[model samples]
Target: MPKTISFNDNWTFTKTDSPAYSRQTIVQGQPVTLPHTWNDSDGQGGAEAYYRGACWYQKVLTINAEDLSKRIYLEIGAAGNMGEVYINGQLAAESRCGYAMFRAALTPHLKQGDNLLAIKVDNSYNNEVYPLGADFTFYGGLYREVKLLVMDDIHFDVMDNSRDGVYLTQASSGEGVFRLDVRGRLVNEAAASANGRVLVQLKDHEGAVVWEDSQELAVADAAEFELSGSICNPVLWDGIEQPYLYTAEIRAIVQEQIVDTRQIEIGFRTVELTADQGVILNGKPIKINGVCRHQDFGGIGNAITKAHMELDMELIREVGANSIRLAHYQHDDYFYSLCDRYGLLVWAEIPYISFPSTLDPDSRNAFEQLELLIKQAYNHSSIYCWGVQNEITIAVETENTYRIIKELVAEARRLDPSRFVAQANINGVADDSIINTFTDLVGYNLYYGWYYGEIKDLGERLDDFHRTRPDKPVLVSEYGVDTNPNYHSYTPQVQDYTEEYQLLFHHNALETFKARPYVLGGYVWNMFDFGSANRKEGGEVGKNLKGLVTIDRSLKKDAFYLCKAYWSKSPFVHLAGRRFVNRHEQLNDLVVISNLQHIRVYLNGELLTEIKDGQPLNVIKAVRLILGDNHISVEGIDEQGERYTDEIMLRHVLESDSSYIYVKEEKTEHVVNWFERFDLSAPGQIEVKEGYYSIYDTIEQLYRNEAAKAVFLKYFAHVTDNPFFEVTQGVMSIEKMSQLVFYGIPPELLPVINRELNRIAK
Candidate 1:
């Protein structure tokens, strides 16, 4: 049996000025733990930004005398961007990809006693490693677990970025029997020929060996072996219903002695995405209720533990989601294992995102990184598809771009012929684009309601795409609106940080998805808010507030219950606006989300109303609130007589109190054909004055600034006469225009905007 030890403790760390190797550098570092990032303080959000450069980590390995005969290797679960490892002043290995796992053989450098293990990690922006310019922050460090593997002279090949050098591919042949093909490589380090037998066993959760096979091989320094067999009456690894896993044990035998052994926990299942039937798992059709997730937590960037990953999965599963889209990059290996165990279907993709960089270096790095991802995560049954690229069409595609993408898809299929290939295209990709015709599965990251177009356009856009590519499976990969719990509007509009808008947006999107059979599924933009240092929009600075749950994972936005009511089988009722407590409106709509059939609501101990004709996910009714505090209660009963109840207290303040009062109605202008006209101008130059954005910046910041609005309105009034006001409104952000109106736009400024637009037209 092979043994492994934790190499996470007793490490010293220090920031370095350069990526060069030196013995004195390790001596000058400070003590730290295995999972440490230099960006813990400044990476999240600040004007200065975090340092993205080289860092050093060193540790002493005191080997036991008896263990020296064993082959030793250092396995890094993950390192940021690039890493160079050295043992006793000698370079062992170098890895460039930040998200994938890598390993180095330390057996040759290991002495009988103490050995020096040093690593230089550089997360500096590079042209080779992916995500050259992404939205989320990339924190640098040796941010994941490190392990030391000790094995016999003859062992399984663990040198490459593989799932321990052993891979099992299974397909449901017929009559519930699965044909399992197991293959693995063996290394005879002594360079001696030893006639060896590779023994493979399939054990159940009860530890009973259900199938066994052996392949005899004439072993050289390195050799390969494979075994084929059928498992009779095997328990299927069903999604969420029953995530049964089987253990595959591979052992190498020499002269009746077990030289080396490795065991892998695996699930046996078949996944298919069809145009007519949607996602089929194990011969049964199922809908994918999913969400996209980033790997960072609130304060602790990506240097998280298995416990943190488990907690995230648990939260996802509790939301009634049976699937997850691990967005933009390969996630932690342990998270994939949890997905297998918990029965969540996953769409695993690489960060070959945004667009192609330098074809020679960047494309090469992308292909290698993607290969590493597939190899290391091949055996996990949770992954049903491998994503090639995400939103790559956002930039202009060149001939090299098409060539590189084609190569990526080909490489992914060549490496793992069993999985489906998919890509998330930007919304701008037309129906006739060649990019859409390449993948087995394709999803569009379209924010129709929030970004530019009306909410009603989503259904038609998806229908048009399906009509164009009737053969390919389509998914609405990402769609959602941002919301700050503090902002609430009775009449919500786009870009308004209101919980109501998010709720309505999801309601509309889900209805559209439910109506379309050809659409496979949709993954909501985010499961939780994440840190983005440069972001300052939607009442949040340095954060993407589109998550169903807040950043801290403590508060679930109102939209969370809406999804739960739609996806979860568990019967429950939740009152919305639990966070938005103080209200100034005299009449408010009390919303209730439940998985039950009907809901009875009470306000201030009085039976307010009982709603039977409600949407599948939401129940809303207008309620009149008295002065001071009002207590609200709800009770719901499913058809099976399962009763669920919840309560919340809300305060009603008079509008005359005059401190952040609520508005029932506001003057709003819906800008039609805004982007169509805006795209005509190449972002026309407007001088940026000190401490301000361009002239158009009024759309983002001046909404609530009285003094600033006065300055801009006066400035616009002087530009031109009746500055084609209708054209100006149509050529800018409708949400921003609506904000300008709601907060107070001067009537004279409309003509000024019109005149300016007319001058630009001339």
Candidate 2:
């Protein structure tokens, strides 16, 4: 077995722009612990953008002389954007993409004792690195666990970045029979290659060896070998029903003695998406009840702990999510492992988000990141699809852009043919767009009622897309509205930041999905509100309130229940708008969301209405509001007579009560050019409007072609004054007046935006 130790304590950190290093810098550095970040405070607010530069971490690793004979390797769980590792002042390894795990061999660089291990982690805004511009904050630091693994000479290859020397992919052949394909890469440091023999075994839940296979191959320095076998009776890993897992032990033997061993968890299942059949799992059609998730939590800025990850997974499961779209980028390996153990189907991808101004470095980084993501996550059975890009149309698509996209999809298939390749497009991108045709299954991030059209428009647009792309499978990868728990609205409308509007938005979106079977899945934009750093809308600064739950996971919004009503099978009733206790409207709608058919609503002690066998959306009963506090109770009964009920106390206020009465009426000018905030001066308004027209003219002239300018205008036009959308769109309206006014935008973003604008300007 492999021996490992946590190397996470007693580290020194400092911010440095220079690449040069000195021992004095380390001695005077601030002391800190692992799971720490430099952007903890600065990255959470919109007061000023966080620092976009490099930082250094230094730690001393002491190794005994006797342990020097073992093969030693240093493993970093994660680093942000870019990281480089050094031992005893000598370069050991450097990793470009920071999300995945990387292992560097340290046997050659270590001394007898007291080896100095220095790591330089950079989250600086680099135009070459991916996510140069995305919605989420790119936190800087070595924010995850670091470890040292010691093993014998004959060991499995941990340097592949995937960290697994062994891989397992399983499929059901027939009744009670399964095919388990295994791939193992081995390294023999011993003088003679003839002494190496690899052993692979699969063990059941009871720890009994059910299948065993051994092979002897010609091994020089390193060799990759494959084994094909069959299991007579396999316990299938079905979603939520039976998340069964089998343990696999692969041992490398030299001269009949076990030298190194690796253990991996394996799940047997198959996933397929058909244009007409939707998602098929293990030969059964299953609708994907899914949600998109961001890595950061309330206090943790991407420095998530195991407990944090566990809680997030628990919450996702509680909300009845059968699948997860690991949005924008690859997550921690441990979280992917949890998905394997929990049987949540996953859509894993790289940070190839938004649009790229130039295809050179951004697409180059995308290719490298995709390689690392697939290599590290290849063995996970939970990943059914590999998402290639997200909303790249935010930037103008060019011939070079098309070339990069086609390359990514082809490379993903070449690397792992077992998983389907997918990508998410921005709204307004036509179904016949060339980019949509690159992926096996196409996904679009659409917000109909909230962004531009009515709720009913969701179904119509989906139907239109399906009719056009009848041979291709499609999914609504993201759809949501920002909702603040503190905000309440009687006449809710788009962008009201009210809980009522959130519920209605989801109710309509879910209804659209229910109407079309061709749309395989729909994932909510977010499961938990996340830190956007530069966001100022939604009644909260530096946060995206589109999540079903709060950033702290403290409160579940009313929309969460609306989703549960349709997605969950657990019979339960929840009173919507419990947080909005003070109501202004006399004709109040008392709504109850439940999976159960029969629900009875009671006002005070008297029965108001018996909603027998109501629709899955909601059970609604209108009531006249009293002047003071009123008690309301609702009970739902399942077929088995098991009852789930909820009650709440609501206070009715007169229309004259200014604090309780809330109404929203949208202005056409403000709605069309939504980027301008209410704080703009009369002169500033004229300047902004002029800048907007100038920006559009520049885009048209620079793109030259109608197609490119059309795509560019879709993202930049009507952008909110907040640069959050600007970063995502990658288009800077370089009207000088506009840039000077929007000073809150990080200084680093200006260079990127201006460079693209200047390209067109010239």
Candidate 3:
């Protein structure tokens, strides 16, 4: 059998790029371990000042005299953006796609005693890369595992696109039997042909063989073989309930001697997406309780350990999530395995996100990355759909852009016909646009409550989409608001970044999704806060606080319990405003969230109210509190008669607490009420003049007219010069545009600019 060794230790890393390397040079560099990134701190510290250039990692390897005759290969789990591997200062292998595994044969370059292995990794701005522009920071390094494999002269092919060489396709063979077709490649590096027998065995979870087969084949340089096996009354890999898994062992035998062996964990299941019934798994309808996740940690950036991934999985499961959308890019392989074991449906994708790149007309990088993503993760049973792109039309939607997206969808289908292809469209894309019809399923990243419209608009908009495209299956891919735990409000509003508002938004969203059977369930925008270097909202810079859990994984916001109350079957009760203790209002609303049906509330040891057959959320409105400190307690009983309780102390203060509010730095004047500064003396003075331009006109219209263009530049030059302007030029009117990117413009000057544009003739 082949031997695999860890190559993650005793590595030296440096931010400097040097053409020469020696023992002294490697010793002089900072000593580091594998799964390391240089941008751990700066990447999360606001301002787009993180390092994004080439860095070098060097390691020394020693080979014994006896192992010189065997074949040696280096396997790299992943590298950010791009990487080049060098052995003894000689280029051996290179990979451009950052999220997939690749391997290089080091047999030819190896000598007896000692060898130097160096890797140059770069995460710089590359227009040719799939993620040309996105919201998350691209932390650069060898952010995954590295290993070395030693095998005999005849073994399974390690150069097959960095896959496991063995591919298994499974299907239901009627009468409770599952059939599996196994295909694999074998290579003989010796100077002659070799005859071998390939043995395949299927083992159950208890390590008992359920199926076995063997095939005899002749190989010259390389050859392929196919074999089939069947299992009777197999246990299905159900989602979350069972999550049963089987193991497959493949061995290459030459003349009655095992040369190489490979083992893989496999599962059998079936998934179907229907327009009317939503997702069906194992002949039963299942609503996808999903959450999207980013790979970075609080301070670790992208160079995270397997323990971190395990903790994330535990947290996600705790929140009663059955599915996870691995957003934008591919994640570590261990995460996929965890999903398989935990039975979490996965939506995996390449990072063909945000703006489409015209620099590469064919979208070659996009296609290549998709190929890598699909081929590398083909065997994992947790992944049900392949996401092609996310918000690609946000910047400019042209014929070329549409063509590239269509091709990507086609490529994804061609690569994995068994899985569904999906895309997440930006909010403004019309329902009838061709982009919505390019995939098997379509998801809209709508933020009605936070970004543009009222919270009630979410269900109405989804209803409109169902009426327009009844044949298409739809999901709400992303929807969230940034929340700061410190900010609290008795009467929450949009963009307040308060825990109360976050709870209100998700409560409404969850109810909306549950009410509509035609619409598939929604995935929360994020499970945890993440680093977005360009974001400066929610009283934090370089971070998007739209997560149920804090970025550091130290705190679970009140909204987390709201989701847990709805989805989890476990009996528990949670007080909604645990952090918002001090309040000025004499009469306040006390909220309780629990999975149990029977709930009771008490104030200062006095029974306040009781609810029987209650829903997940129960609100006791206008409860009068004492002048000083007051005690609130909620108790619930499940069907099993088990008791669950939660308690909190609220101080009824005489004066309002300023610390509960998010105080914005005075920006000359408060821009939020810019429209309030409009002259109301003349009732309808701001009305659009006929055949003339005004704030009501689209940005594209105003930019086309010379007179209106000059007026627009006079007062709003900063808006036109912003990168966001390109994303909204043709799609949004000036009045609506200002609502999104309203900064720097003085509140008092808005009416003057509108009046100036109102004077220009169309």
Query: Which candidate gets the maximum TM-score versus the true structure?
Result: 3
Please give, for residues 313-413, the per-residue lDDT of candidate 1 as tens digits.
Answer: 98898789999999888899999999999999999999988745543433788898898999999989899999999876454455666777888989999
lDDT order of candidates, top first: 3, 1, 2
Better of 1 and 3 by TM-score: 3
Q: Against the true structure, whose lDDT is highest?
A: 3
**How well does model 2 score by local distance difference test?**
0.78
Q: TM-score order of candidates, best first?
A: 3, 2, 1
Model 1's alpha-carbon lDDT is 0.78
Question: Which digits, one per residue and each the tens of the lDDT, describe model 3 over residues 1-762?
Answer: 789998898899888877675223554689888888877877787444777898889888888898899999999988897999888877889988888898889889888888888888898877777687677878889989899998899998888774788877777777888888888899999999989989999999899999999999898998898899888888998989889999999999998999988888888888889889999988788888889999889888888899999999999999999999999888888999999999999999888887665557677988988988888888888999999989876656678878988898889888777789999988878888888888988999989889778999999999999999999999999988899999999889998899999999999999999999888899998899998765678788778899999988999998899889888887899988988888899999999998887998999999999988668888899999999999999889878788889999999999888888988766434234444544534333456678878877766788899888887665556456544465455544556544443443434455666788878887
Better of 1 and 2 by TM-score: 2
What TM-score does candidate 3 get on C-alpha atoms? Answer: 0.90
Error of 2 at 506 (Å): 0.2
Off by over 4 Å in 2: 16-27, 46-49, 174-176, 190-194, 357-362, 619-621, 655-762
Cα RMSD to native, each candidate? 8.7, 6.5, 4.9
